[model samples]
Structure formats: structure tokens, C-alpha cells
Target: MLTEEGKKRRDALDAEITERIAAFKVEQRKMLEELAEIGIHVEMVNRLPNLPTSDYVQALPILIKHLRREYSEGTLASLARSLAAKDASEYWDELVAMYLASAHRISTGPGNLAMALAAAVAAACPKNRLDDLTNLVKNQRLPHRVLLLTPFKKRRGRDPAVARLIEELRHDPALAKEIGRWKILPSQASLRSH
Candidate 1:
């Protein structure tokens, strides 16, 4: 029923479709081989350490409840107290350190929360904010006199080192002016009464 020209065109189209299918299968097989070689390390990164239960919600509620307190000066005292404890202290030090260290490698895309915050908080280059923070700490440029005035809370939260810093701030007015920075207090009026 087909004319010669129509039959030729149909055969050409079919050949092209077959070639594309064959190419796709070859590519798919390579990807499968690569996956087999690598095994299952993809989901390992999202996991937190030392988790005790399958119910993560149940497991870390106490910790999260303590950390996400209502913002205020009095609350800062409590935050300081928590951060002063060994576990909380380590968390802040590590978290901040990690933030500062990774700022350089990440892209300033729609997905990067830590990078954006780090740049705003530290007044550093946006793309390299983490590097700047890390380098500052490393080179002793990390606001030696950091006041750490959070709107209501410290980013590092309850941690022992933060507690130590708070105690130091209580005695060190020089450091206070060097960094009138805060994690929660948006303005002087917001400093909690009591």
C-alpha cells in the first residue's frame, strides 16, 4: 500500500529509532555496572550518629525541645547553661566549624541554607563564607571579642564551649564591642527582661 518514497522514509525513521534505543540500553548498562561496583553508600550520609531508636522523632525529642527554646536574655542564660554542658558544647564547636569549612566548596544555588546564613552572619564572601569563618578561627581573626547577641538563641545552641564563651563575655567588655552580633536578639528592646 506504500509508495516507494514513503517506504524509504519509514525505513530510515525506524533505523534511527532502533539506534537510539540501542544507545540508551548501552548507557543504562554502564550505569548499572557502576552502581553495582559502588554498592549502597548513598544513604549513609543522611544518618545521624548514635541513634538509639528507629523512631527518630521519639529518640531526639528531649534534645530538640531543650535546644529550640523561646528567645530572650533569660533564655540565653539557659542556652548558655545547656551549651556549657559537654555534649552541647561539642555540637556547637563542630557545627560552626563544619559550616565555616564547607562554605568554599558549595555553590550559591537555591539549595544552600548554611552558606547564605554564614555570609550574612560573618560579613564574609557569600561563596566562601565557611572558608572565611574557618580561616578566621584558624588565623585568630574570629571576632576575639564576640558579644554573641542572638535574637533569642545562639546558632550553635546549647554547648559547653558556648557556655565558656558566655562566661568569658561576662568578664570581657572589650570583646563585646568587637562583635555586637547575636543569634536571636534582633534589637536591644528584644533582650529578654529578667
Candidate 2:
């Protein structure tokens, strides 16, 4: 435990991770600004694939920290949607963390956050991670429960992982009863509004 070489190696890795996180934040801000200029929308979400990947596996937790503390509701939702569209498997855990950390924000309401969480879960999470999605669906927020269920309600062939999630929920009597109470929650204001 007291080896100089090991300590040096650890220090170097930490420094590299810090540098990568900084770079990712810069690129994320630049992309957000670009989206800001164009107006955040489905079209903006569609443009995310054009941006270079940030190698999120290297810096996901840092990115999630930045997202949780600083990003606006619309921007968070847009980024989540973009991540969904990209469907980068490496991004799922941090996406879930971001959703859990910020889901209580009253600014966006649970609807948008739930939608974003659903999109991220549906697009990025693999079959093995279905348990995480199930846990997220059990979030205390009613909108989280309802909105997370939305993606699963789609055709089974569209996303089999999500379909599996639907089946899992169906077998859980508690979730089955909860899913039945789904209601129409109000949508958020336009994404263009800061």
C-alpha cells in the first residue's frame, strides 16, 4: 500500500480522468449552446449523433455531477433525449444517477424528467440493467412511475429490453396495480424558454 510507483500511477490516472471530465464539460456546454441557438426540440435531439462522442465511459460520473448541479430543466431533458437517441450503453448508469438526483426539481416537473429517464432507460440500458429501470419506476414520484411505464407500453418488437421490463412489471402485483392508475399529466412549457 505504500509503494511510490503505485501512488504515482494512481495520481496519473486521476489527473487524466480529471482532464477528460473537463474536456467533456466543455464539449457538452458547446453542444448545449449550439442547441440553444437552434432551439431545443426533437430536431435538436436528432442532431446529437453529429456531435463527436465524449467517451462518456471515462467521465460519466463527473458529467452526471455537472448535470445535476448546473443544467436547466429543458437542457437536462434535451440532453437525456439526445443520449437516448445516441443509445450509448456506457451512459446508462450515470443517466440513471442524473435522473435520480434531479427528478425532484419542480421547475421541469416529473413529467419531462420521467420522459427523459424513460428514453434513456429504453435506449441505453441493456437487458441486464432492467432491474435498475424497475427500481427507477418505483421512484416516489408518481410521474416517474407513469412516464417510465410509457415506453414499455409501446410495441414489444420496438425495444425488446423495454418489452421485458413490461413483462417483469406485469408479474409484480404491486407494479401492476400502480400501472393501472396512469393518468394524463400536464406537459411542460416549451424547451426554448431558457
> Highest lDDT among the candidates is held by which one?
2
C-alpha lDDT values of all predictions: 0.35, 0.53
RMSD of each: 18.1, 17.2
Q: Write the per-residue lDDT of candidate 1 for residues 26-65, one digit (tens) a residue.
A: 5334333433344421121112222322323222323223
**TM-scores of all predicted structures:** 0.22, 0.45
The stretch of ten residues in a row with the least summed lDDT in candidate 1 is 40-49
**TM-score, prediction 1:** 0.22
How many clashes in candidate 1? 21
Best by TM-score: 2
* Off by more than 4 A, model 2: 1-29, 32-69, 108-111, 140-142, 150-194
TM-score of 2: 0.45
